[model samples]
Target: MSDQKPSPLSIGDFATWEPVLRLLWAGSEVHHAGRPARVAGRIGRRSWSLNLRTRLPSPGRAAQVEDIREEVDAVKRVRGALADAGVDDVSFTAEIQPSGEAVLRLLGPSPAVEPGIGTPYPGALILVDGSLPEPWRRLPDPVAGAVPAPSADLKLLERRLREGLPDAVGATEEEITAAEARLGITLPAELKVLYRVTRARWEDYNDDHEAAGRESAAVGCELFDLDALYIADASSRHCRWEFAAMEAVDTPPDAAVQGLVGSPGWIAFGDTGGGDRLAVDLTPGPRGHIGQVIMLSHEESIGAALVADSLTDLVLGRPSTRSSSARGQRPPATAWVTTASLKNVQAAAHPGLEALSIGVWDSAPLSLAPFTGLPRLRTLTAYPGTLADPLEITELPGLEFLQLGPQEWRVLLDARAVPRSLSAAAIVVHGNQDPLPVVALANEILALWDRPRIVQTVLEGAVGPGPGAQPGADRRSGGTPQ
Candidate 1:
């Protein structure tokens, strides 16, 4: 299929180039891998479908049920992303076509009739009469003498990171500058250092030095290489074009359809091998942490997974990304992981202070004053407590959520001060406590909060016999279970 003219279409190119193709004519992905796979009947009203072959290396690969299933899974993920990206009804279908190539299908709005350029192929789009409308090659060149050199901080970081590499992974300032010009934007400062240091995966860095599958490195540092496309041509196609499409398909539910800013303005810079991406956020989310790194996973319930605000933080024990040294063992580097036992965290010397949660009896006192150094601490949840206190969490600078003993939180409501950063609080309300008191307290908490915040009561214990049953209660309706 690689040698075929017009060739078998790719799932990505079919989506991108077909819009350009629609300028001249209305077309749809009809079939693929020796069978009919039309999504017109199944697609939602606001969406379209693209059908083409799987982008596998070999021809007729989709004829195998395994390959077909792979493409189907890929399409489902892409559709879910589009839904989150605020693109309504952006779904797709695929099948093995009669020609033995997989056919990819996408269903969206009908293409507009505006004059357009660019073929489904790599080159610039052109008029039917052979006049150029858009480049078939790379983006237009940047004007001379206007491009900015790499920042000093970027250079210093690069120098510290570039140890042992003689040629510095073959990236040059000229290449990065050209890429910025083509994309019409400068990279974030740390990203500039990142690309300059290396564009290859750190795992693959020792491929040349591997002696019969053994691993070795000259440096003892725990830092891993970040993914970068330092070259202009790769960035334009992979970063600029393909990254936009990937983000569009994975738009967060809160974003607007017309003015969609995907996953809080994050752009893909590295891949996590599990279809998740590491990105640099251009538009800060409600957290107001700008230029921070985030993980975008189609599999994630909330699409954005906060990694770190900077690269240096990732390498240290602060906001460490998944590392062989830390992962699958004990306490994770940051607040991102969940563990069954707090003892494991203490044994690992990880503090487990950031976003800590534990099942503690209400009488047990949790002191925030002991961990005063952990400024990143944001959430604290303890349950089945007899009392709670706002003073326990008053000093946490980043505390956004607190769940503690009911008595403590109630007393906290009456306390002279509450943490300004405390945006949400959850507390256990024993059945013996009247609903009116806690309900009124919830209202007072909401009224006291200047911004939107949540106050929730987790009910426990039985009020004699339940309405429908004698013992436990249904979680949803708050009624007794049969």
Candidate 2:
């Protein structure tokens, strides 16, 4: 044996395994027990090695090891199958640990395999390790709650990550600055790092980008976690708070600021100027259930008011399970807008109204004439219940964003009337209607316009089972609205 000891490997060496494990678990019934699977290796090169360790349930050690070995053989067999099926340079190795768990390693040029290849076997533990590129490390953790059928479009992980920031943890300005001063280093760069990984989770749901502004104002110092000090500095635009993970503050492309500071991860900020920072903590509670909570704090005088306002806004924006009456009783409103409330407003005919989001209301036809006279009324979303010839949308010259329900589409199609100067329009057809009629109506609407930048036609089943079902049943059925 050589006298020199083996060089220690860096965390980057085992990067590929993370994505592979994510792919394996995507849409599968695997549970990640919170313990990170160990990985040791460099990816893509033959010399790179991989090791993964996981615990197996106690009952069947020998049989489990044999089954794991067969599973490894199955992966190798699948690689050969992919090659036979015209995929190239694909190879993998799998082995069972002494503890009756499985470890998988990709040996060469990574194969393009379907994300959900292995059939899920209950009670089997999975651990994957490899050396992958940095880009692979950034892949979002597979959706945690439940698994859907495998999709050929693996970019769904990317989509979820893009949608919003993950939960985060935050600290005050004085707390962070004191820590930095104690460390004898200026804290600008460190603060930026923490914001980048955890900012996206918040941004996806922010709707107006106001939360981003709030986050930047509050995160003023550096904090440490995962062996890295996440930096939050207001002065440096490059380090300005973002949702996506960042490697360095000086990286270019100003547009990336939104992604870096907003991506999902724990974040801490200093409240130097009395602004409150929001942080999400994803820690396990007593029974091993993962718990997430958001914390906000501001200075003594205005802090309480600011906290109340921010919390109210955040809570109201989220989808809630409580009834409107119950939710409205609280200090902040968290209930979905109701048709009765909307119609009541129209009946009252408030002169102050400029724009209305009528999409959520049940169909009740009201003439557009009253809205048209109001100089400021520029947007209307009406879902008139299953009735034809209720109102003429074209009468409103100032209308910009028009949302029509299935009944309205039928009326518009039958009348062969197309509105002029429409900036954007969305039409949703009911599930009860034959698909052919909806398709035909959509075709007719498309033909009426020339090069319209914003037009969408959706089928009812595609939107989810018609609202109003047993509690919790509705949750599983709804497809994302386009």
Candidate with the greatest lDDT versus the true structure: 1
Prediction 2 TM-score vs. true: 0.29
lDDT of 1 by residue, 330-353 (tens): 344233212344432233223444
Off by over 4 Å in 2: 1-345, 357-364, 386-391, 413-416, 451-482
TM-score of each: 0.29, 0.29
**Per-residue lDDT for 331 in model 1?**
41
Model 2 per-residue lDDT tens digits across residues 209-289:
565554342332121232233322221112101111112111112111111222233233333234544332222111111
**Model 1 residue 321 lDDT score:** 35
lDDT, residue 51, candidate 1: 35
